[model samples]
Target: MPIDDVSAGHRQELRRGTVALACLLRLRRPDYGYALLEALAADGIDVDANTLYPLLRRLEKQGLVTSEWSTGETRPRKFYRTSDDGERLARDLTQDWYRLDAALRGVIDQGES
Candidate 1:
């Protein structure tokens, strides 16, 4: 792989863990897969459909999220929202992220010297 490809792969590896955290945060208001995809993209997290559908399934299976079908609409959609467990996890992860971000900033500032 080229240098750019290698760096891209490393970037992706760093972001992989953030997906679940982002999903949990975004689902606070309840949304379907497609809407969630757009929301994530708007927020600078680009997640494709194939990846999202399965991640939603896994989150539901893990009890981190709850899903319900809205049949009242002409096109029924399965809406997902963060469960209590998910909310707690999101909160914890957010705190961890903030601490990590501060540490990273310090490291970067020192390296620039």
Candidate 2:
């Protein structure tokens, strides 16, 4: 395989876990599927619709999010919002991320020495 292919695969693997965290954070405000997709893209997450829809379904199944269909508009859309469990999870994940960031910083700093 090409070096680029290997690097791309690793990059995607790292991003996979982060997508769930980003979704949990953004869903603090309820949003429809398309809106959520746009919001994630605006935030530089760059998730595709095929990937996003499955992740949303999984999050909902895990009780990290709740969904409802809104019919008051021209077209009914399924809206998702983070649940209490999701908020707690986000907080915990944020703590973990900070710890990992600090550790990486230490490693990088040592390398510079």
Candidate 3:
């Protein structure tokens, strides 16, 4: 397999979990699907609508998020926000991410020694 293809596979695997975590963090404030997608992109989390929509549905089903429809606009939009459970999960995940980052940095530093 080409090295680029190998790297791409690994990158996708790494990003899979991070995307969920990023969505949880970002949805602390209510936002519609498209707005959430744009905000995530602005924050450097590139996720496709195909991926995000399903993820949102799953999160809502899991009680990690809640949604309500806004009918005031000409086009009604479903806005989502993180639930209490999701907030807790986000905090825990953020701590784990920090721990993992530090551990990885230590490994790299040791390798450089």
Candidate 4:
């Protein structure tokens, strides 16, 4: 049976924070918004392009990412990479993610058993 709308919405909302972390980690390699969106979805972190574009802009504004237009390509695309500060933040956040993952797994396992 399908998850109810409230459960699905809550699940999506909880994923938003992880999506930011995923983008920061994945975009250590330069990528445009669409490519990053595809990569995230491929990795089972499905996020909409509309949401990603704005989040990228916000990250840039907050000095967590750097971006440039790739004029070398036939179609100019803006590519973004994690800035030095972003990399540092990602490292720290990754540690926290591991802790959170462990804690959540314990809770899930308890529910299962």
lDDT of each: 0.95, 0.94, 0.95, 0.92
| Number of backbone clashes in candidate 1 | 0
Give candidate 2's error at residue 6 in angstroms. Answer: 0.3
Candidate 2 residue lDDT tens string, 1-113:
99999999999998888888999999999998899999899999979899999999999999999999999999999999999999999999989889989999999999999
Q: Rank order by lDDT, top first?
A: 3, 1, 2, 4
Q: Is candidate 1 or candidate 4 better by TM-score?
A: 1
RMSD of each: 0.9, 0.8, 1.0, 2.4
Model 1 lDDT, full chain set: 0.95
TM-score of each: 0.95, 0.96, 0.95, 0.89
Q: Please give the lDDT score at residue 51 for candidate 4.
A: 90
Tens digits of per-residue lDDT for model 1, 1-113: 89999999999888888989999999999999999999999999977788889999999999999999999888999999999999999999999999999999999999999
Q: Give the per-residue lDDT of model 4 (tens digit) for 1-113.
A: 35698898998888878888999999999999888988998999989888999999999999999999999988999999999999998998899999999999999999999
